[model samples]
Target: MTSPDSSAPLGVFDSGVGGLTVVRALRELLPNESIIYLGDTARVPYGSKSPDTIRRFSVEDTQFLVSHGVKAVVVACNTATAHALPVLQATFRVPIIGVLEPGVEATLAADSCERVGIIGTAGTIRSSAYQYALAMRKPDLQIHATATPLLVPFVEEGWTDHPALKSVLKEYLKPLLDKGMDTLVLGCTHYPLLIPVLKRMLGNKVRLVDSASTCAAHTQRMLEEKGLLRTVKSKPTLEIYLTDLAEQAEALAKRFLGTEFGKVKKATL
Candidate 1:
C-alpha cells in the first residue's frame, strides 16, 4: 500500500539546477511538505535534445523520483514539459505536472494577440513548440522567438550578476525587444536566471512570464484537491539528487534556491 506520507514529498526535476526556482516557489507555498529534486547535470541542457531523447530522459528522471518514494512529479524544464509531460504522467501513478502549460496560461492572461517574444535555447526556439502551443489556443498572437545559447551557459557559469552577462543579455534580447513584444516568455528553465537583465533590457512594458511560480500554484492546488497538503509539520522536507557534478550542482543550487544545499549526492535509476 502507498504510505499516507506518499504525497508528503513531491518530486521535482530539471535538466540542471535551474529547476531550483520551482523548488523555491514550492517551499514558499507548500511549507510543510517534503520535496525531492533531481537535476540531470550530466545532461544539463535538454533544450537542444531531440523530442524522442527528451522523452526518454524525462522517463529516467521520473523513475529516479519514484525510486525516492515521491507522490508527485514536477517536470521543471520547459523543453521537457513541452515534449515529455505526456509520457511522464502516463508512466507514473502519481500526479505529473509540467512547466509549459502553466506558463502558457500565464501568457494567455497577460496580453491579447499582440506580438509575444520568446527566448530560450536553440532547441526550444528551433522546435517551434511554444508557437504551436499558443497558436492552437490563441492563433492571432504574433510569435517571435530566438535561440539564446549563450544565456544558458552564462547562467550555468554563475554569471548572472556579471557585466559580461549584461552584454550577452543585450545581444540575445535585442531582436525580441525590436519586435515590440508586449510579453516575453522565458521559455527555458535556465532563462529565469537572466530575468533581471532581461527585464532591464526589455523595459516595464514587456511582461516576463516564466513557469516556476505558476507551476507551484498548480502543485499547490493539486495537493489541496487531493487532501495531500501536510498540516502536521511546520517545515517541508527537502531531498536533492544529482546525476553528476555533485559539488558544482550544490554550489549552483545556492544561487537558485537561495540557501546552501550543503551536499547533493549522486543517484541513478
Candidate 2:
C-alpha cells in the first residue's frame, strides 16, 4: 500500500497461466526491470465465474503481490480487468494497470477502420467491457464480438495447434470474419498464446491484436514518468506463485513464457 519503487519488481497477475503473455511482453519492452508473476491456477478460467467472485479473487491476487513489494501491478486477465480494475486502482496505493484500458486504447489507435472484431471468453464478451470501451473511443465504430471460451482451456492445456485447434478457432472466429472486420482484438490474455493459429486463420486482411505488448509499453512509460525505473545490477529473477501447482501448469506455462522454468512454488495466502 505504498508508492511504487523502481528498485522493486513489477507484479503481474491473472486467473491462470495466460498472464505469461504479459510477462513475456514486459521482458521484451523493459529488459532491465525485474518481474514477479502469479497465476491463480486454483481458480483458473475466471471468464465463467460471477463478477463478485472475480473481484474477490482479484483482490487477493493484488494483495499477494503488494505484500511482496512490487512497484506496480498489472491485471492481465480480461475478466478481472472488466470487473475489478476500477476498485483496485481506487483502493491500491501504487500505480495499477489492466489489460482493458490499454487494450481499448490500442484497439482504438488502429488505422481509422470502421469494422472491428473482438474475440474473448464468454464472461468478457458478456460483460460488454470491450464494446463499451470501444464506444467511448469511437462512437461510430462498428464492433463485433463473440466469445471463444474453449481457446483458454485449450491454451492452458498446452494444446496450441492440435488438428482440432484449427476447427475450433475457425468456428470461434467465423462470426468476426462474417462481420467483415478489418481488425481483430484478442481480448483474452490466453488468446495470445494461440496467435500463430489466429494470424493464419485471420490472414493479412484482418489485423490481429494482442494487448500484452501495448500493456507492457504503457507500464514502462508510467514507471519512467514516475522515476521508478529499475537498474539491474545482476540477474533479476522472476518469482512465480500459483494457487494450484498442477504439473500441466508448469509444462504449459513455459511454452507461453518461451522458457523451460519449472512450476511456481505455491503462494502463501
Candidate 3:
C-alpha cells in the first residue's frame, strides 16, 4: 500500500457516540492531527446484529471516512472490531486499527493472576476474539466474558451514575467477580464512562483496561512507524457526523467531549 499523507485526517467510527472516547485519547496524544468521526446513530447497536450486517455497515463507514481523505481508519467499536476488522483491512489501502488486539495485549500485560474478565456487547463477547487472542499468547490464561448490553444505552442517555445503571452493573459483573478475575477489560468503547462505577464495584485490586485508550496509543505508534504522523502544531480539526440524529446524542457528545460539540451534521451513509 502507498504511504498516506501525513497531513490528512485520521478516521474513527463506531455504531454511535462511544467512539468519541477514542477521539478524546487521540486528541491528547496526537494533538496536531485532524480527526473525522462518524457515528452510525441510525443503527446504534451493531453488537446484536449479524456479522454480515456489521461488515456492511463497517464498509460504509470506512467509505465515508475515505471520501474525507483520512490517512488511516480506526475501528473504535468493539463489536465492529471483533466482526469486521479483517475485511476492512483487506479492502482498504490505508492502515486499519482495531480495539480488540490492543485491549487483549493490555489486559495480558496488566494481569499477573492469569485471570481476565471482559465486558462488552453480546456480539463481542460471543465472537471470543479476546479469549482467543489471550489464549494464543498464553495458553494457561483464564478468561471470562460477559455481554452487558444495557450499559450502552445507559451511557447514551448520559446516565453513567444513575442508581439503575449501578444496579445493572452489579448484576452484570457479579459473575466475573465470582470467577476471581484480577483484570477487567472494558470491551466496549462506551464502557470507560462507567470507570468510576467500575472502580467502586471492582475496587482498586482489579485493573480496568479501557480499549479506547489502548486503541489510541496503538494508532499513535502505528502512525509514527509508518511515517504518517502529522507534524504541524496548529489547532487540529474535529468533525462529528451521525447517520441519524438522536435527541440525547448531542448531550452525550458534550459530556464525552467535555465541551460543546458546536454542531452535529447528518451523513448520507
Which ranges in model 1 have alpha carbons more than 4 Å from their true place? 1-7, 111-113
Of the two candidates 1 and 2, the one with more favorable lDDT, higher being better, is 2
User: What are the lDDT figures for the candidates, one per model?
Assistant: 0.82, 0.86, 0.89
Which scores higher on lDDT, 1 or 3? 3
In the range 24-86, model 2's lDDT, one tens digit per residue, is: 999988888888899999988899999898888899999999999999899988999989999
TM-score of each: 0.91, 0.95, 0.96
Which candidate, 2 or 3, has the higher lDDT?
3
Clashing pairs in 2: none
Candidate 2, number of clashes: 0
For 1-269, candidate 1 gives per-residue lDDT tens digits of 56446346889999988999999888988777788899998887898788899889999999989887787889988888878887887788888888877887888986453888888777677777788888889988888988888887888787787888888777877887788888888887777777787777667888888878888898888888877777764556688888886666778888889777546778775
Off by over 4 Å in 3: none
Decreasing TM-score order of the candidates: 3, 2, 1
Report residue 100 deviation for candidate 1 (angstroms).
Answer: 0.3
1 or 3, greater by TM-score: 3
- Give model 2's TM-score versus the native structure: 0.95
Residue-wise lDDT of candidate 3 within 206-245, one digit each (tens)?
9889998898889999998999999887778899999988
Comparing 1 with 2 on TM-score, the higher-scoring candidate is: 2
